[model samples]
Target chain A: MKMTHKRRDMLVGLSFIAIWIVGFAALTLYPLIKTFIFSFQDVDITVEGIVTTNIKFENYRALFKFDLNFMDLIRMFVEEIFIYVPIIIVFAMMIAVILNQKIRFKGVFRSIFFLPVIIVSGPVVAELFSQGATTLPLIEQYGILDIVTNTFPESISEPLEKMFSEIIFILWMSGVQILIFLAGLQKIDSSIYEAAAIDGASPWEMFWKITLPSLGNLISINILYSVVTLSSFATNDVLRKIRIDMFSPDEGYGYASAEAVIYLIVILLILGLFGVIYLILRKRSVRMS
Target chain B: MITTWHKIKHKLIGRTITEGILYKVFIYLLLTSIGYIFLFPLLFMLSNSLKDIDDLLSPMVIWIPSKIYLTNFQLAFQTLDYFRTFFVGLSVTLLPAVLQTFIASLIGYGFAKFKFPFKNVLLGLVLLTYIIPPQITMISKYVLFTDLGLTNSAWSIIIPASFGQGLNSALFIFIFYQFFRMLPKTLDDAARIDGANRYYIFFKIAIPLSVPAYVTSLLFAFVWYFNETYIAAIFLGGQVPTLQLNLVSFAQSYTALAAANQHFFSINEGVKNASTILAILPMLIMYFVLQKSFVEGIDKTGFAGGE
Candidate 1:
């Protein structure tokens, strides 16, 4: 009877995962492989079906050499991720700490920060960016942009100006990360802080020793989430360029697939770097404790 | 000496006899600036939407309009086909989100509770789905759907989700797995000892205990589906217009209609802004009404990933 019960448990578990496995295989894995195959072949749609001709590395070669702006866009994508991810993570951590503080109308503050997540997909955000609404009339009136630009070298100033202009956009994207951090903050036991306070630890020491170490997992999660969201965001020129290239009548299916494969590799490499950092932090924290 | 200065500083700005007043002031300062930053877009949109062509053209009339103009709201409503498209949006969003949440929970429960063959491999694949961008697979999926004659049909979006493969369904699965794993195994053991069947235990015990997870997964899944533009545009085409798509195309459509009517009542930025505002009104109302669950749901949804 026990043997049969064990067998039945296995059966139930297998049945539960079966649907996901099937769907994953059919919808995700199969499509991914098909895209990979099409990356090497010239594909044409006819009345009956798709026709394919093997084109070897022509698509990849064209991707690097023929596409004039592709390399520049790739560099911009990498640079933006490096700059934006840290700003977002730090900004989010600060906001989360503020929101998590004992204060009046905490819900109102949270709602304000989170509102962008809901309405950002609407035309208002895109319109605001395009029309210079995000530049703030006061800043522009004060010639802050001009002053800041003159402070830096021209090459550095251009990206700085762009970043300054999109300050609101950056804040808006930090909503999810802030919420994640706030949740992480809530999970830390208050008793630990109480004990530390009794031992005469200052707030600064408490933050580094207890708070930051406890939040390592959440930090990594936020890092991964922010990285993915920033890369695939509607405004990410890399994604837009990829989509345009995909349907571009000049490059067609094969070339776009190769570009996509390259995009995927870049994303993976970034994530891998974060993963390594997370591992190192975990080991160091364990040692320190 | 620094410790003496620190004591003085603490007396002045840190803590007082009032207790937490300093903290309150700091929090309020932070909140106000960030709050203003977040609210600026909506405020800008409202200001723009209410301005007439004359006010819009005048650079001095940036914030306040000389006179309020309300016709843009009416024009946007009519052009957007608000009632029809609203229902279409609701059905497409709710159906998949609801189905996907339940399916994801079941998969997550399985992964959390029982050991099976290739379980690690299966879990790895689930994570792969999370990290992999949807854009990479979009083209082949589109082609497949087109061949299957599912293009321009809501079924194209709905069917895959029913099997737990919707937009970021992997994340939902992961969330549920974390929630379920946190549950003590003693509950399962207790149920088994009581002669409760596996299905009975899951239906009775696991489902009831996972209310927060259900709420989080369903709410996020709904929002993602509602705001999805790329896949919706590709799949639904011109047959069904989602709120996001309609907001985007409102300008072009308005211009086309105006041209047909000999350019009577020329379209302006106000109309476009008005349409964008009106398009988000339903979501705004829904969010405000259910703001507590929405906020708490996000808190309950994600688990820290070290384990």
Candidate 2:
């Protein structure tokens, strides 16, 4: 019996995606559900097998009521997303714009900028951080840290201090973002810039009116990428804590799962917040144009 | 004289269409400075790795060493168990990366070309996987893998990856989808008219055209897997020693080795720096070797045109 063309296509499509479907169910979906369940239960490992008790919201309650450190970690994570995302996006955009120009040794510059992405593992970065290689010594030598601390209030100064201390490492995180921005920058038609120029737009004016708006979608993409990379980094204190708590006799799997759930929710919230902001800005840009 | 000076200023700072000398200099200066910032840590690592005990301690010596230091490298080489761990690292990272890349290509081809029910939803699900942190599922995956006796072995990584759930697999699928979608449908249609089956058309037409996607995805997968320690540490159970895992325990390993040999030299910054350098050396070499494709492949990945 011959199948209809539409049916044939559908079957073929399903066949192609069959492995992914199975994988998603087993590896992603099942585990996701299991994690959710595990978060509410008191999970224990026994000699015979695994065991769980339904202790709904107890793990979460304990986390909020007792875990002060978890709260601090969450605050730091949110602060990092707020501080690092814009800095990375802006730095990446700046470097990408420069690299996109008609310049000599562009390849050399590009390779140098992208070097960090290749070698930035958890251990390598941890070693660098331990050895004080991640920071620029000049910042200390030049007393920029002192000035910033003195100038700003504690709330502002704290993040500023972090920014100064890990300045190079922060810049290192921009390697992939730079490449992403560069790709976006390259795709912009030069004719638009030319037309704007003909209409008496200065370079600065062209950047704001044409380049920035054209890169609106890319800005959001970069923001998402930066947030994910920063959050999921191996050496993240919160992740490290979760991993530690997983094996602790007092906490076990349930508490750790609860922490993971909270972390996931926070990440989703950040992404949602960014998505809303991006949509609002995009709408404004469209209306303005 | 005033008119001449004004003319010179205009020439030095060209209009929007053309970059003038001042602008060109400014661009180069900015690029060079930022480039320095990017290379600072690497330079610091290299310089410190070469420093001896005296040079490391001495205030006079900053960027350069007083004398060349081979002892640190020797010590680091021993501490890392360099050769054995390197291949072990390859077994987990490279093998899984290859499997992940191939599977991602097939899945991407599916999403790109085929018009099927819930296609958009499925594709959205693929991206949703990327957004979901691996930690959320890791606990359950750990339990599952432990049950299957896949823990502490490469199978734990390889199995998930082969099924298209590896590290950053969704991004690769998206990349291939972008690449395959960009290919003209006429080629596939022509092949079909000649009585080629769907699989035949895909294998012949689609795979051949998407070399850039494959290369880009493979490189990224390899690098990501190679660098991944959190998941590796959890799943591998520290029985399988990758370079990254080894590096994490470098100090302990060094102490243990020193005790075994009964040679008591305190672990110094130079030795630690050397180990760090050694850990990243392979990836750094790979990046330089594939420098062009590494940079240019970003363009081919169609990252600029997001869904």
Candidate 3:
């Protein structure tokens, strides 16, 4: 209770250090290593027991095997990012700008938009965001992609129609971005806006120059978070279906792990790319000042 | 008229209500349009709930309820396993929420108050853990729980949650760390002079002051775990159907209600609406009450630390 500062400091440091290390090792590092190792070895998950045998690079090969169609799995992620990421950023920025403006019931709009983060799974809040609600209505109104191909040129309109339909579904998933944007908007200093207005900057110009630049850090975070979330949303039902369609026990369960590893590697590559990009952006921000 | 630029200036400070007739009308319309977007879904869901089985099942149920059918409420509840499922889900949700929040706070306090070596390293690992999808952790967590014989039991959720690995916990630690830093260190110093130990200081001096974080964390964890999918879905899918999982039945049944009408429930349109209403009733009620604190709690998280 009444010890020298040095003794107290030593005691606190030692105990805290021990807990931090042990906790991290048990909770995080162990799982990372164990799971990585498990990816290579054959593990029977279906039965009551499993055996771990070194399959070497066999798992990796089987992932790309003709029957498994490993490339398609990667393609799913690529296709997802191509169509989904742009839509998320654009819509989120738009909503944030509106909310940032002086408006009545500002809090109401923020909460409604932020609702998705709380209930991302449609099934959970079936009351609020029924899976069928938005997507179904849009498809109904537009009559799906079939309507497009029927009425318009196949080459020009077909891809656009498909992309449009996909985007409508993704909008239901933008709750997290909304929250991040709200945080970002709160951080933008009012003095900057004042300076811009004094300089006779139009609202549009202000948004393009000051608002977007100020949101750089948050935009980066939101983008990374959105990508990670969308990928994992590879629904359990989807995984189950894939397994049932492709499961072959005697083949050592190599192909699926290979597919998992491929996606894992792809994710790592994306994160690495993002890390470099963030450093560059931070440097730019520093230099701009 | 000098009205064009004059109207724009008022909006910059926070908009002026009294303007030229044209400007006033313009402001009203713009406000209405934005407000309409927010109200659209609520209105849509409402009308859909009212529609009769025939119209609700019809793809035409897109705009309005067409023919109101109040009975849908009764049926959806039955399909959702109303009383039994809700109670089980509620009981399961409450306990884990309480446990998870306490553990998260403990971990958060540990990180915030104690000046530990490898502190940054530990925090970094937690940040990296966010990158690791919970889906990826499934098989490993499953194996561990199964080995401990916690499969399909309450311990399955509670034990892992206690480890402070849950996102809710880590985020709270980030939040709590900031909140703790803002608190004057005098409380701890006073407690030390009083011969109080760490546990005593935490519970008596710190926790009493951290009520906002505690209440908000409770609400956050409860709302989240209540709606949680992966862990509850895979772990308790067969044993105990949580509130979220129970809605799956309607999803399957409603898959092809009215092909042309899309969302129009087949013959049981009323049941779908009722199910939706019942399932979200708790969330809606709770949201209205703690809606202020809940939003503020999340917004407060790690904000005071950034500066």
How does the DockQ of candidate 2 come out? Answer: 0.76
Candidate 3 residue A89 Cα shift, in angstroms, is: 3.4
lDDT score, candidate 2: 0.89
- Enumerate the candidates' DockQ scores in order: 0.59, 0.76, 0.30
Worst 10 residues of 1 chain A by lDDT: A118-127
> Which pairs clash inside model 3?
B56-B264, B57-B264, B58-B261, B59-B261, B72-B270, B73-B274, B76-B271, B76-B275
Model 3 regions lying over 4 Å from their true place: A1-24, A45-48, A67-70, A122-132, A136-163, A166-169, A234-256, A285-289, B1-46, B57-63, B190-195, B250-270, B303-307
For model 1, the chain A TM-score is: 0.92
Off by over 4 Å in 2: A1-3, B16-18, B262-264
> Clash number for every model?
0, 0, 8
Q: lDDT score of model 3?
A: 0.63
Candidate 2 lDDT by residue in tens digits, A21-100: 99999999999999989999999999976899999999999999999999889888888788888899999998898888
In candidate 1, what are the lDDT values of residues A1-289, reduced to their tens digit? 9989788889999888899989988889888998898889887766778888999988888878878688778877887777778889999998887777676788888888988777666355676787676766667789889998989997677776777788788788888788888998998999998898889887778888998887887898888888877766666777677778777777777777888788889999999998998899899989988
Better of 2 and 3 by lDDT: 2
Using alpha carbons, what is the TM-score of model 3?
A: 0.81
